[model samples]
Target: MPATLNQLGLPAVIVVGAIFIVWFVAGNELMRRRGRSLAIWSKRALDPLGGRQAIQWITLHSFRLEIEGLKPPFTSGNMTGLVESWDVPITWLINRLNGRRDMVLVQLALRQQPIRGIELFRPRSLLAGDARQLAVQEGWTTEPFEEFQLAAMPGATPQRLATELLAAIGPRRADLLRLALRRRGLHLTLALNIPNRQAVQPAELTGLLQGVAAVALRYATPAEATD
Candidate 1:
């Protein structure tokens, strides 16, 4: 009886050990696969918007603008002006990533400059006609506007272009802009929740965000000063 029990025990131990090894290996591979998937998805999504190059530009030149109330004695300049400034940075990033630096020059001419306007209604004032119109125009159906303000800066420079870029990208990517601009620094954070939840993968989200940033920079410019 003793001999028989020993034989059974040895096989059982071996089997358990083998199972553990397999599980560990599989788990590690799964993690690696997930990471790679995320990256691929991100790149594919951002391809049209200009890829890594755009992201780099935003990382280097992006700045945070703070606003108070609806008035525009902006501590620096007009919000629109600030958007304009971002143009070169945005274009540089996108074009570089897309490997289309040559296209950047041509795109520059087509880009629109920032236009200063008064905020007729606060974002929170959904009841206001202007706010509602903005919402409709931007295709914002569910989210409420957090702030509503306007600026009337009159100039054409990098700053103005940056401001215009921000405005153009704001409606579609308000959440991203908010996160990127939440702090006063060059590094920006991107929320990968949407793509992640969809099981789209980390790489994919990164690529997509990078692309969007590039496009935003490419088309953004300050309104030509009417002075």
Candidate 2:
């Protein structure tokens, strides 16, 4: 009976190893597919704004998108976007445990500095500390606006700016976690809660871009905002 049990243990180990190998391969393949689909969806969604010149996959569930030569309405400069998804089972589990979810980040570096430095973000955000540090360094005042905290230099009119920006974002304001107008550019991070295998819509992306563009235009230096 002891000899028989030892012989069965070796077979059981082999079966378990095989199952793990299959799962690893299948899981990765699925993640890859989801990533590629996301890239396509993003490109299509951004078509009205500009053409996507490049896309690089950082991981099976993460990708970076580059849109060169942004069309009118968006100031000439660089627009970089990245999408991070939790499709892999292990990663999804880890992210869940950490109380984190999928997110999309977009950074637009304008050729001109249109607006004064300001940062607005929700409380307890990942970059809340950074905003605080920026406020202290620039001697900016910090205030609260609804569920978001606003930091801006004197005479920057934090209230007005927050109102305009939030209005531009519309109902989707809930998804917006951060919107900062830096010295030379804008940074936006939106919390994504996409269910199933669906992708974000074109109009949704368009709205966000238009909102940012509107802010940039409103504060443009006139001469510097041309073309």
User: Which lDDT values do the candidates have, in the order given?
Assistant: 0.32, 0.63
Model 2 C-alpha lDDT per residue in residues 1-227, reported as the tens digit of each score: 99999999999999988877787787667666666666666666567776445776776667777666776555433323333333355765665554344455566655455656677776674456877887788778888878889888766466787788778777667566677776653433333333332445756867776777677567755644446
What candidate 2 gets wrong by more than 4 Å, as runs, is: 1-30, 75-99, 126-139, 185-200, 224-227
Those runs of model 1 whose alpha carbons end farther than 4 Å from true positions after fitting are 1-7, 51-180, 193-227
**Candidate 2 weakest ten by summed lDDT:** 76-85
| TM-score to native of every candidate shown | 0.30, 0.69
lDDT of 1: 0.32
- lDDT minimum window of 10 residues, candidate 1: 101-110
TM-score of 2: 0.69
Question: lDDT, candidate 1, residue 168?
Answer: 41
